[model samples]
Target: MTRSELVTALAQRFPQLQTNDTGLSVNVILERMAEALTHGDRIEKRGFGSFKINFRLPRTGRNPKTGQCVQVPAKAVPHFKPGKELRDRVG
Candidate 1:
């Protein structure tokens, strides 16, 4: 679900917390995740999943439209690996 939906769900689940507080909590969690990712750190939540950064090397790719060669720059991408518990639950 989207962030708003998540916030709503959290607010509903925790009746003592205000809607704004729930939103802030969600934002803080996401901000922390972003900070960790920015520093090339991995996050592993038990029974959930792990998030890590993967590097992509520079490569030459062809443009589908023009069929011309293009140089693709290297980049770091976020990767997620589901924990066994999560996989088992889904399965």
Candidate 2:
């Protein structure tokens, strides 16, 4: 679900939590996750998945539109690996 939907669901499930509080909670969690990823840290949630940064070396790529060769710069991208429990549940 979208972030807003998650907030609404949390608020509904916990009557004590206001929508605003739930929204803030979700924002804090997401911000922390992003911060960790930015620092190249790994985050693992049991029964869910793990998040890490993967490095891509610079390489050449073809431009599909013009069939021209282009240089691709290296970059660090976020990657996720589902845990066994999550894989089984989803499957």
Candidate 3:
């Protein structure tokens, strides 16, 4: 579900929590996760998954538009691996 949908679900699940508070909490959690990734830190939620960064080496690539050769710079990308529990549940 989308972010807003998540907030709504949380609010409903925890009747004691206000919708605004739920939304803020969700935003904070997501922001922190993003911050951790940017700092090259790994985040893990046991039954959910893990988030980490993967580095890509610089290489030559072709532009799909014209098939022109281009130099691609090295970059760090966020990657997620599902936990065994989550994998089994999804499967």
Candidate 4:
């Protein structure tokens, strides 16, 4: 779900929290997760999934429009692995 949808769901599930508070909480959580990932730290939620960074080595790629070969620079990218419980539940 989108951020707004998640905030709404949390607000609905917890009547004690205000919508704005829930929104702020979600924002804080997402910001912290991003910060952790930026620092090359792994994030794992049991029965849910894990997130980590993966490196892609530099490679040659072709431009789709011009069909021209280009050098692609290496970089780090985020990756997610679903937990067994999550995979089984989804299946």
Model 1 per-residue lDDT tens digits across residues 1-91? 9999999999999999999999999999999999999999999999999999999999999999999999999999999999999999999
Which digits, one per residue and each the tens of the lDDT, describe model 4 over residues 1-91?
8999999999999999999999999999999999999999999999999999999999999999999999999999999999999999999
Error of 1 at 59 (Å): 0.5
When summed lDDT is taken over every stretch of 10 residues in candidate 3, the lowest stretch is: 75-84
Flag regions of model 2 displaced more than 4 Å.
Answer: none
Error of 3 at 77 (Å): 0.6
Candidate 3, 1-91: lDDT as tens digits: 9999999999999999999999999999999999999999999999999999999999999999999999999999999999999999999
TM for candidate 4 is 0.96
Pairs of residues clashing in candidate 4: none
Q: Please state the error at residue 11 of candidate 4 in Å.
A: 0.4
RMSD, candidate 4, Å: 0.7
Clashing pairs in 2: none
All candidates: TM-score: 0.96, 0.97, 0.96, 0.96
Cα lDDT, model 1, residue 55:
99
TM-score of 2: 0.97
Per-candidate local distance difference test: 0.98, 0.98, 0.98, 0.98
- Name the 10 consecutive residues with the lowest summed lDDT in model 2: 40-49
